[model samples]
Target: MAMLTIKDLNVYYGVIQAIKGISFEVNEGEVIALIGANGAGKTTILHTITGLITPKAGSIDFEGNDLVKIPAHKIVSLGMAHVPEGRRIFAELTVLENLKMGAYTRSDKKEMENTLEMIYKRFPRLKERKNQIAGTLSGGEQQMLAMGRALMSHPRIILMDEPSMGLSPLFVSEIFDIIREISESGTTVLLVEQNAKKALSIADRAYVLETGNIVLSGDAKELMNDDSVKKAYLGE
Candidate 1:
């Protein structure tokens, strides 16, 4: 069974439609990339799935439960974590404090501690700066903290929005490597990215969105080699 399924999904902000009736599915343990240009509604699709924006029509099923009716907080408790765009870390909080906040919905102290240890293992920089304030961290470190914070939730699936944005080439590669490591460790990933080639290269499957609609979708390898994708997104 799919870990997440969206059918006939639509979203709007007041009178303007942000997402058309789009559908997709994320299977357990797969890295699925949603690739698109700016304002293509990729982020909007993520927001709707996570309940950050209510859908005007359609259904979102996560592990067989209806997500449209659930509140955002409740959705998080259901094992869906979203690392939004712009790395929305709490600027004034310490790295450790920020990680703790990710587990606010959980009460199992032992498990939380284990997860924290795991995050530290995955991001040694975060461990080194656990006591440092978040706002002072460099861009690369801030991205790591944001990702680490999401992992603290022990989510079954993570929704990441433009995680490689605004990073140096070295940092972009590092972030994608981390994403691969996370997927190998058994978490499903739904990634939205503007860097289409990089994202498709690492994904198991990919969807192409344009102007608020999905234009194409298939195995990532195939999409990466397609002429149109190469010309339009890969700068080939």
Candidate 2:
């Protein structure tokens, strides 16, 4: 079933329209990608879904609740986690502290510790540097920390924005592998990525956006082989 559904989303910034009546749904245990260029309003869509940016018009339903009506913090407790662009970890905090912040909505300390241990297992580097200051980590390490932190929330669905941005080729490959692992571990994913090739490679379904509109959408492999996608996004 649909874990998250966005219908007729319209978002505006001042007098400029950012997202224009776009809609998409992410079902349980599926990886859905929103691939587009920088100005295609991809990030805006993720922000809107997570309740960070309110749409001028639309309905965002996560499970059964209208996300548009829910407060951002409350939304997190509703089983949605967002790993925003730029690896926005608290610069001064330790890796453990940053991860702890992600579980702020939860009250079960023992459960939180169990989740933290699970995260440490997935990101061994994080476990090794659990006490290291977050700001001191390398770019790739910071990205890992961000993902680990988001997982700490025990989300039913995770929204990842540009998880591979600015990484070295090896790190990029590693990050994409981890994304697939996350999906396989049974967490639904809505990924906003400019790395169309990598995004489509792992997505079960994908939507192509341009200037705030969804221009094409279908099975990920089919879109990967589409001529237009090759020329415009795959750099074929």
lDDT of 2 by residue, 1-236 (tens): 58888999999999999999998898899999999999999999999888899999999988899999987878888999999999999989999999999998889999999999899888999999999999999999999999998999999899999999999999999999999999999999999999999999999999999999999999999999999999999999
Q: lDDT, candidate 2, residue 172?
A: 96
Quote each prediction's TM-score: 0.98, 0.99
Cα lDDT for residue 40, model 1? 94
Q: Which 10 consecutive residues of model 1 have the lowest summed lDDT? A: 71-80
**Worst window of 10 by summed lDDT in candidate 2:** 70-79
Error of 2 at 140 (Å): 0.5
How well does candidate 1 match the true structure in TM-score terms? 0.98
Whole-model alpha-carbon lDDT for candidate 2: 0.94
- The Cα RMSD of model 1 versus the native structure comes to 0.7
> Which stretches of candidate 1 lie above 4 Å from their native place?
none
